[model samples]
Target: MKHLSDEQLVFHHYQVSDDGHSVEAHLAGCEACRARYQALQDVLSAIPVTPVPERSADYGRQVWQRLQPRLDECVVPFWRRLFERPSLPSLPRWWLAPAMTALVLAAFLVGLFWSRSRAQDTLASRLRQELRQELVADFQSALNRSQERSSNALAALEARLANDSKAEARQLVQALHDMLGRARAEDRQMLLAMFRNWEEDNAAAYVTLRQDLEELASLTDKEMRRARSILVELAAQTPPPDPPFRINK
Candidate 1:
């Protein structure tokens, strides 16, 4: 079984514990906790209670009356004592009208001067504001014009560059076409020269073969047989001819 703490017992004694029933059940079952709780109750009961004194209905008035003599001994301010004394001479009634008129005139003059100064200041401020606004407007107008001019210049430059590029491209294409036409003409001339050389070589080879055949035909039988054996030996010793050269269209 769990024992109750002193704080729990104190809360239970004051009936301030949220789990009052559980504390009570624990105290009933636990002998040590119950004895501690009983000692706490005895100690609290033994402490003396101090009673508050009651005040009468006229207490505030009685306090004021008791302090009146001491308050009276305090020094009065010089300005208040001077006004309270009866020995000072009073001013005459005849001078009051002129004094009042002079005071009113002075106040009116001061007010007029202040009003004029304020008017000048306001006008100066308004002029400054208008000048600033005009300066800003002029600056903005100049800036917009400058930006527009720059934009137009940039556009013109881009257009010029584009035209130049197109012209250059056309020239390059024409140059390439002329170069290809020249190359094809050179190739045709080279092919025609090779064909002419091949025809001349074929004619020479035909003339030599005809001479050899006529000499073989004019020989005796025995000489022909000897010549045929020598030819067979030469044919056997010679390298084979290369294949014909051909060109694709």
Candidate 2:
């Protein structure tokens, strides 16, 4: 025997099929089919239907009017939708581009500032070095010129002293020659007496000359000592040159 299908039984239960009599007759005659239909009816009847809440007649229209903007918003542009979607790291999709651009720009600015600072430092250091080199060269040149001046002054002083000494010696020789010629022209007896007197005066004069020479020698020694002290002081007062700069690299 062919059993009625579940579709026919459901249709018979709901009275939806055109041929309901045949499924009803099968359910009434066949115990298995009858039991199945009873079980289905019992299960369905056991489930309670929830009652829907009642509202005013304009409620649907009002709700649709309120939600229309949101539904319209749902039809977002493709670009906006793409940006609104989130990806990895829990970051918002909209914030990614601006954040990346800001980060890249910040990094570029930092690198630019650092490079500029380094270049400024290098330029300042070079300027300082050049200034120092120029000062050193100037000081050395001044020192050389000073040494040359001192040498020339010392040479001139020595030459002047030599000329003065020669002039003094020549004057003394001329005066002595005049005195000797006058003595030779005088009488022998008178010359002898004059020589005796001259010897006595010469001895006295020689003693005075010896004392004057000693005093002049002392004065010369003091002058030489004073000049040496002045030279030492000048050398001490001179400033030293700056040390050269060194680079580790």
Candidate 3:
């Protein structure tokens, strides 16, 4: 025979099943069904039952009173307020068309002004960049020209020095004087100091050479030949160039 289902057992336990008598007869005959029903009753009975706290008659009123301030502070959004229709004076129906046209015109004017200002700013920036590039190019060109002139002047000075003639020496002195006249005060002072040092070294070399030449006649043939070779080597050596002049801004 089929045993009573858990649903039938539960309904029978609660005294709600329509066939409670038949379920009870089945449980009495089947030991397995009776054991299952007992287990279900034990599980339900193991659960803890809680009692609800009693409230006073004015509980709802007290809750509503506590929440009323917060509700009053609730801010309705702008869009919702618009939908609720705020109390403002109504405009004439015919004025709407002209007002819309004016709004569109204002927006167009603002956009046009902004675009023009941006264009002007861009143009100004481009012009400034171009001006800076031109200035740099001009500065580089001037620097190159100055370097070229200085090189040429040094080459001429070297050529003059190579000549052993008194005329060449006079020309060199004249050229230096001309340069000193054109130079700034600080450059003139530096050039003068360099010239003084060079003059002292040259004077000393000249005195030494003169003494060696005078003593050559008293020396033996082999010693004279050695002295002549030494003199030739000294004459063959080139003098060092003067410091290059630079203009400081």
The candidate maximizing lDDT is 1
Model 1, residue 24: C-alpha shift (Å): 99
Minimal lDDT window, size 10, model 3: 82-91
In candidate 2, which residue ranges exceed 4 Å CA deviation? 1-92, 167-249
Off by over 4 Å in 3: 1-86, 164-249
Candidate 3's residue-wise lDDT over 1-249, tens digit each? 898888988898879999978898899999999999999999877887787899999999999999999788776777887788567855689999999999999999999999999999999999999999999999999999999999999999888767756787898999999888777777878999999999999999999998898777556677878989998898789686667996779
Ranked by lDDT from best down, the candidates are 1, 3, 2
Clashes of 1: 0
Which residue pairs collide in model 1, if any?
none
Evaluation by TM-score, superior candidate among 1 and 3: 3
Pairwise lDDT winner, candidates 1 and 2: 1
Per candidate, the number of residue pairs that clash is 0, 0, 0
- The local distance difference test score of each candidate is 0.92, 0.89, 0.89
Which candidate, 1 or 3, would have the higher lDDT against the true structure? 1
